[model samples]
Target: MFNYAESIASRNTYMTSIRETMAEAQRSKPAVTISMDGDADGKSHRFYTNRDRLEGDVKIVAPADTRFDEIYITFEGTSRTWMERLGVSPAASGRTSVSQTFLRLVQPVNEASLPIPRVAIKGQEYTFPFTFVIPERLLPGACNHTIAVENQSVEEAHLHLPPSLGDHTISTFEDKDDLAPDMTRISYAIRVRVLRKKDTEDQPVVLADTARKIAVSPSIPDAPPIHIQDRSTEFVLRKEKDLRKGLLGKKIGRVCIFAEQPQPLRLAPNSSCPPSTRVPVSLTFVPANAETPPPELGNMTAKLRTSTFFSTQRTSYTPTVSRSTPDPFVGRYQESTLLSSRCVSNVSWEKQEPPLSSSSSSKPVYKAQIIVPIAEPKCKHLVPTFSTCFVTRSYTLELSLSIRTSKHSQPNLALKLPLQVSQPAKDSREHDSAPQDTSVEEFFVPRIISPSTLQQEVAVMAPPPPPPPPPFDRRQGQLPQSMLLHPPNEMPPPEYSVFRGTGGPPVRIPPPVGISPGCG
Candidate 1:
């Protein structure tokens, strides 16, 4: 009985290209419906309708131990035939003159659930009832063929029925390519699809809840004892009691810590904590080596006031420029010692203020054996030469003096007017005997140079010009006979005679006119 709805009503007469009013509905016997749902309800009598080709049939009834998943084939038209053929709503044009098929089974059950069966017949709708699921796994054991519905589109349609013989004898079974190479199995199927497409944007945002994993175990609380006091320091806290009892001042996350040395100490982390809170374990102390200290390290300190356990007795006045003698009760001053009186003394004073000295002079001219500028000053006293007030915040005055001179008082004399010895004019008139004559005159000039190959500097007159002195009184009362006719061996001979020029038989003066005619 292979009547899968009469073979999909003989394949809907090749579906639609219309043309089959069949003689106007056979002379009005009327009743010519064409809506669409399933099982080919187009009530045939050999009516072979056609368009391009659309053959249909659906009669999937698996509701017993239920097993037949998915066979949705909807095409019901009429909202004026879908606005005259698919303009909207097939549930809004998600395109579907639909068809889908998926079914797999081979024995399985757990409460045996199955539903996915819809086969309305012609007015068109087809499948989509429990949305297909028959996998309480294809029931009743001993599988050997039988459940078959494979049509998967040739434009769909083909699901005949009738086959098999149960208990593993559809003919000695086998046929998974004749399996028997040891037996082992698992099978099931029901996959049908279509109905996708819809994703306009996307959205997802979520954050703010910070505090990840912090359960410092072992009962929490071990690190609080740091008392560094050179200037003053201490801060010890181990808190975290209010496990969310009321919810008030909740600040979470802030710990500074820094004082490190041989365990100098640093523990800071308190901005109030509580959100997902777990920051306890504080121990603080800060102040290691304050001001200009090193007098065995004690300028006296106590400047502690941070997150308060109280401290501020910082007495450090190092103004000791002593020559000693100003102790109106222990000489130095900077007193404020007391950390608790309701503890609110946030004190600080770096005041040494007394150091602007030119010796702070007002009239400062006290000169006795005075010389005091402490920072080491030596003195050797004598009677009431008093002057010792070195007291400094900075002061320097070194003026020492001594005057002593006397050996009977006549030692103040400075007069030596005993230098007179004038009288040697025995014959101061012996200046009337003339005898003046000193002469030296010689002229031999020649020095001009231009054509230089470098080196030429001459000023030679070696030796000549000595006897003009024999003319003592021959000057006005003397001979003019050509100077008494030249005696010293003809002295009228030099007018122009010095012939020693031209140095080139020792030839080499040819290098001046842009000379490059080579050949030395």
Candidate 2:
């Protein structure tokens, strides 16, 4: 897996090298620089949400009298995907690729005010200031293919502008690399080109071109909970595992775990501090005999599974991104990235009393509410849940619990639950709805990359978590604003029968109440 990601990294780096070479060659010409409004560090990237103003200025410097036809500046968004077909001959694993330029905003640059000659004056500088309102949604043409929207006849969800995805070259915060697969890339750029008019039969020549990359995660309202009923394969809301006495002793009772679909993880509008919800879990223990105390609780941990579904053709049915092995079929391709894990410590299960109609020895039940984060703030570049005609991105929450049943043997209780990661709708009247950093620089030049091939890899390891907030009090139902933060501490080491192991693509670490991910 390391080698796989390494190969991808090397290939992407090679692409960067080629682009850099081209950019270096262009540097000798008249320079065109772009300066945008907000950035935390002039070195990092800028992020935007729905309807934010992407205001910037393009400056042109001419060392000599440069002739030009027109200035072309465009804000463009594009998505590209390619994959080696599964059944292709080993010697010729030809790949099929598809790309779409979905968003293009070209508000004509008003050059009439600055009356300058067709040829620029020698050693002169010119600045064309501009402002583009980031639209609330994309045009209908953006997703013209057949699509499926929950409870809607028309495909409305995919028409909204998807967040800039797959490009992880720059990050403003300590967020992990989105672990996006090379098969899919969604990029947005501000490209400035100086064109020279050509003869009647020839196309215009591009004298100078420069591209500035921007990262955007539009404000996506919380979607209705995705209904998942498949019990055997994709989603298992309930499961039973056997518990034992000592290694040599007879079998003890069985532990059954079950949970209803929890509320969606609500991502707040402002990017700085997003909130997550708790998952309510119930456990029932049936003793083999009469005297079996509840199996000791070892540890509880949560994982986030991000499944990206892409298609070369239009969809006739809503593709349910599954957790089972990938289908060998063609046209539809999927990639699941498991981000870094977060240790949920100190999960206290509240004991539940038996019903009057049931016998005391019938069964024992316990309940606990475990919390998780929408997405940890430590890493940036985490795109929210969204769907489109060509591609769809979704998330599933995998919870695992460790049980100290006996000295020699232990069993784990785990379940796969559907999770929604979404942002609250903006009121349009609130100031600072989408927060921007103060220390923005002129521009951070991003390399424009074309698709390239690489071997596959999925490797994950949990990183240390952020600082924990103050102790939470659940009864109040109102958490102190200051007591909300990503939980602190490292994941507990693996034990016998604890979990399925952690060597895969890192999953996102969700939090409980305010800081931790486990029940308190």
State TM-scores per candidate.
0.10, 0.68
**Could you give candidate 1's per-residue lDDT for residues 1-520 as a string of tens digits?**
7588877876776553244664443332211112222324443212111111122222222222212222223321100000112334575433222111222322222122323342222233232222221121112221122433222311111111101111122111322121111111111112222121224634321111111110000111122232333432122122112111123432221112121211111111111221111111111211111222111111111111111010011111212323134332222222121211111112222223234563442221111111111111112100100000111111111111111112221111111010111111112133323343323212344445565522333223345568665544434545454444334444443332222353212223335466564545
The true-structure Cα RMSD of candidate 1 reads 51.1
Per-residue accuracy of model 2 over 158-233 as CA lDDT, tens digit each: 6777877777664532355554666777877888998888777478878888887877778777676656665656
Candidate that scores best on lDDT: 2
Model 1, which residues run further than 4 Å from truth?
Answer: 1-275, 281-283, 288-520
By TM-score, the best candidate is: 2
Score candidate 2 by lDDT.
0.66
How well does candidate 2 match the true structure in TM-score terms? 0.68
RMSD per prediction, one decimal? Answer: 51.1, 31.4
lDDT of each structure? 0.21, 0.66
